[model samples]
Target: MDLLRYVAFTDDPSGGNPAGVVLDAEHLDEPTMQATAAEVGFSETAFVVPRGGGRLDVRYFSPLAEVPFCGHATIATAVAHAHRHGVGELLLNTLAGEIAVSTSASPDGTVGATLVSVPPRTEPLADGDLAELLAALRWSAADLDPELPPRVAYAGAWHPVVAAATRARLAELDYDYDALATLMQRHGWTTVDLVHRESPTLFHARNPFPPGGVVEDPATGAAAAALGGYLRELGLAPAVLTVHQGYDLGRPSTITVTIPQAPGTGIAVTGTAVPYES
Candidate 1:
């Protein structure tokens, strides 16, 4: 029942998103896991139960509830396992689906993990839902990017992909927390992926995660994967892309996404993780 803390997407411990990792939680039940996650007080915590033969059963829990999948926690868990065991591939069974993760150590001895999300898909955002969501965020249709249309995307979890027309719009994030949470709950969305495309291969993002009882997520892997899927589906992705997030919060994070040419395949998200002191 050792609770390990690690920050994902940054080598600096204080820069990325912090996640609680229980490497071995074979005996803990759902209630205990939920309580432990709440006690950790991070955006999300990962509970890993070894199923033997390089396979692990993983569960993700936010402070308030259990989520189907979590990208940052998954990255943290993989890095933690690599530190304790060794760098290699792991098969993770999550509520969303099976995810494949590979861990490696760089020349500088930095541990990095790349996770291949389950096959991703996208659905159109209904006009009514879009109006309500914009109202919640205090944003109008004019604020949205004309190129990247609004859509509900899913990799391991669901996220509404909203692209801001300008970087300034993305930077100024003052949203109705309660209203956004209610809208997200109604749509079963894990987070609202607010993004602004800087270049063809570069982007900046912010994630509002009120459904998880958090105002915002510093780095969101699942949402990034979903965004990749949405881009690939629309023929807007250029093989690989970099997403910079958490800068507004002073905890900068970098996420790299690899898009496959094949249709209906998993998206790969890679990032580094380190032991967190705070």
Candidate 2:
């Protein structure tokens, strides 16, 4: 299989989360795709099979397993496709659902992609689930932001949205890997979206993806989209939000989220990605 490496969410190749893109994965089997993703050693790798008509069949894989949907990989794949097919609208059929993406080249020569997720949903976090999550995160109920209550949010994949009262609390992220992984697997959660609100429009985020066999994900697009749904469902956020992630890990990624006025509408996430030197 031919593979291309790119970093999503940042214009600099060294920044953002790195992903492996297989543009021609039509013949690769599930095990081959999984093993290739493991060999790539990135948070996730995207495999694309062209179905023509500006549509593609997309799949995402982490080092350990396959996920229903992945935000960064989607962005990476869209931009990579744009590079070959010319920037425009593209449709992706994923396990989660169909997603629409648009790609373009900025005036400064940076390539960017915007993806609209499937209709989002938010659910109240079960009391027992909250307790277990806090325990695994080494946090207590007091550490939480009262204004933004806990919830399970989904835009393509499921994530537990927990808000921290202070940036200090959000920064110190030492968690029990095994415990969190077990809980995440049982609950079918892709990541835990730990966030700290800096303002009405700006927030800081960290995602622990133990189930993916990664200690942490520098930038998580799916989590960001889920967060948009969570905020909208709770009526806690404005229509536009900016998420800053991977700062602590030194990758520093920026994700722009736009929530429409319509209920249950798809969230749009925008970011730039850069290809790595071969």
TM-scores of the models, in the order given: 0.99, 0.98
lDDT of 1 by residue, 1-278 (tens): 89999999999988999999999899999999999988998999999999988799999999989999999999999999999999999999999999999999999999999999999999999999999999999999999999999999999999999999999999999999999999999889999999999999999999999988899999999999999999999999989999999999999999999999899999999999999977
lDDT, candidate 2, 136-216, per-residue tens: 999999999999999999999999999999999999999999999999999999999999999999999999999999999
Candidate that scores best on lDDT: 1
Q: Please identify model 1 stretches exceeding 4 Å from their true place.
A: none
Taken over the whole model, the C-alpha lDDT of each candidate is: 0.96, 0.94
lDDT for 73 in candidate 2 is: 96
Flag clash pairs in model 2. Answer: none
Q: What is the C-alpha RMSD, rounded to one decimal, of candidate 2?
A: 1.0
